[model samples]
Target: MPDWKTTYAHFLDTAKTAYTANEQRGDLLVQGELALAKVTVDVASNDITNIEREEELTLYFQMKQLLNILRAIYNDQFDMQPEKEDALVAAVLYFVSPFDAIPDDAPLGLFDDAQVIDFVHEQLASDIDRFHHEM
Candidate 1:
């Protein structure tokens, strides 16, 4: 397995580039999120026995939470620091790329995504808690 840190840095760079492209990046964020959901559903419905059901469910929950936060920020319904917003978007952009650290076809591929989301979740813990409370 390669170092996830290097892969994560690459994701961050990709995200920054896409984010500043003068497009409707918020729309891109939503599309990226929906893609992740569809992929997860496809993986879940398959009969791959080695999958850890509990962990996958937990990852799905985190993905939903991140989407909610990003939506709230873009909709002007929630307040978060600028730095945290960058981290959140970077994590979401990981999904938009068809290429993964491990291809999505692998039974455990989403775990790489899980790693990014988990790290971002921790990074934004306070904001997430506040978002839950205030919004």
Candidate 2:
């Protein structure tokens, strides 16, 4: 697997490229990136020694929420459209790998949700048709 920095850079670059051609396509990519970032921070920041079992459950729940949001963002692009299953699965994995960017146990885990969100918004600033494309 590629390093986190490389993976995130690729994601941002790909998202920008996609957005330039299709706003909706780009927005979906950005949403996925942001969602991954959110989960990464939530998981990486917890004090494992102090982490409660319930917190683990909550983390899983939050992760699922983020995934659902991503699915919803791409539902239109996916719905009723025939596409390569491998490509679709690969895309999802690409967006998600950022969560595991740094070793979870590393002290001062890398990446932050705020930074990721800012990156997504900045990268997609000029084009927001994707946001409007949804009903």
- The parts of candidate 1 lying over 4 Å away from their true place are 20-23, 39-46, 49-51
Estimated TM-score for each candidate: 0.83, 0.33
Tens digit per residue, CA lDDT, model 2, 1-135: 455546556555554444333355445556565755655565666544445434443544433433443454455432321222222323344444445455434543333322333344344333323433542
Clash pairs, candidate 2, are none
Off by over 4 Å in 2: 1-5, 10-69, 77-95, 98-101, 110-114, 125-134
Predicted candidate 1 versus true structure: per-residue lDDT over 24-121, tens digit per residue: 56776668677767757755775545456666776778878888888787777987776677687887877555566766567677778778889998
* Predicted model with the maximum TM-score: 1
